[model samples]
Target: MTRVLVIEDDPIIGEMLTLYLTEEQFIVQRVESAREGKFALGTFNPDILLLDLMLPDASGTELCSQFRQLTAIPIIVISMKTAVADRIQAISAGADDFLVKPFSMQELKVRMKAVLRRVTTPKPVAVQHTQADSASMPESQLGLSLDLERRTIVLDGDHIETTFSEYEIMKLFFQHPGRVFSREELINAVRGIDSFINDRAIDVHVTNLRRKLEKNPKEPQFIKTVWGVGYKFIK
Candidate 1:
């Protein structure tokens, strides 16, 4: 039984989410503002959080950053902020995913599972490559080489810090260069089965990866977007 803390100001939306999540067998605790959410955190010990950007007491962005400092719990922002910038900002502030308003409950469930996967799944231990593993080595593209065995990425011979999610996305791209993967496909591949694809979350991850791997993130040379479809890797 997973415990979820929902920090949403709207009583209607909060109740709606609580009812739906309850139907799914999740233990939920709903709060009307960031202050209440923070106060409840110590007692509820929730596994995940459904946060709203607008609150009576504090901004979700500030709460998100504060929450990250206190705990590593997964957080999914449920907000009306649909702009790409808003989504990116939320992610930057520490939310694992962002769902725009008018979203379906089904999508919310899928996204929650995806974020949980990131938290609950054990990370693979980095190791030295064997001859057999060499055959499966991640491909190098545009001076970027991902040493999956070493669990590190080398950009022009320099190692860069990267998150597991970013590594998963990049690995898929390296495995299938020039193959355009829709956001849904990417989420499924990276986050596993029953994962939901939030386009904005995908964009934020891609943007972060591009900054680390590409010479110019604004005009990437390795990862290219297939407008209206998704993204692909090109040498």
Candidate 2:
């Protein structure tokens, strides 16, 4: 069974999550605060974490940074912080995904699975492509005006910081522009995450990524959606 650690302070919410994850056959470990959350890391060896942004003592952002130092376990922020900046900040602070509160229990489970897919997927060493091939290869770095080698996003020729996974996903899309890719295909190619379109996990990541790279997210010309299909990176 997969192990999950839920770092939530609210007893009621924590219990609800525990019950649901339990039914899903995940070994659930519930912690009330950042302190206990740290302790459970050693004992439970959680594959994924459902972290609350607000704690009784310390901030979830702080905890996320600290937890990252100890392990690379996927951290999904379950918070009431619904602002765009807040969500971006949480992701910057090391959250794999930010889930707003008042979300359904069913939604939480699907998100958890998506996070787990990315977290548990095996990382195989990749061969470096040839320089000549690289010359022909158009990377997302160029589409986003980012420097793939330097790992920097350039907006109007200015650098914009992005998470590792975000960069990887962008690179994949940039390499194959105009190709329609299912969420599962995108996840596997980029971060090895599972497709959970019903829960809109891919949409959230794409939105976050667009806001970082696009000058006007409302009118995104690069990333387009296929109603019954999936997402694709277009010109």
Q: Best-fitting candidate, measured by lDDT?
A: 1
What C-alpha lDDT does candidate 2 achieve relative to the native structure? 0.69
Quote model 2's TM-score.
0.56
Write candidate 1's Cα lDDT for 152-235 as tens digits: 666644555555557678878888988989988986776565433466778878898889778788899988988999999984
Off by over 4 Å in 2: 121-235
Models 1 onward score TM values of 0.56, 0.56
Q: How large is the C-alpha RMSD of every model relative to the true structure?
A: 7.9, 9.3
What are the per-residue Cα lDDT tens digits for candidate 2 across 1-235? 8888999999988999999889989899999988898899888878788889789978846767777556656677888877877766666566676778888887777766766654432121223444575466656434445465555555434455554456556767877889998877765664334321222445667787788766688887778877777888875
Clashes of each: 0, 0
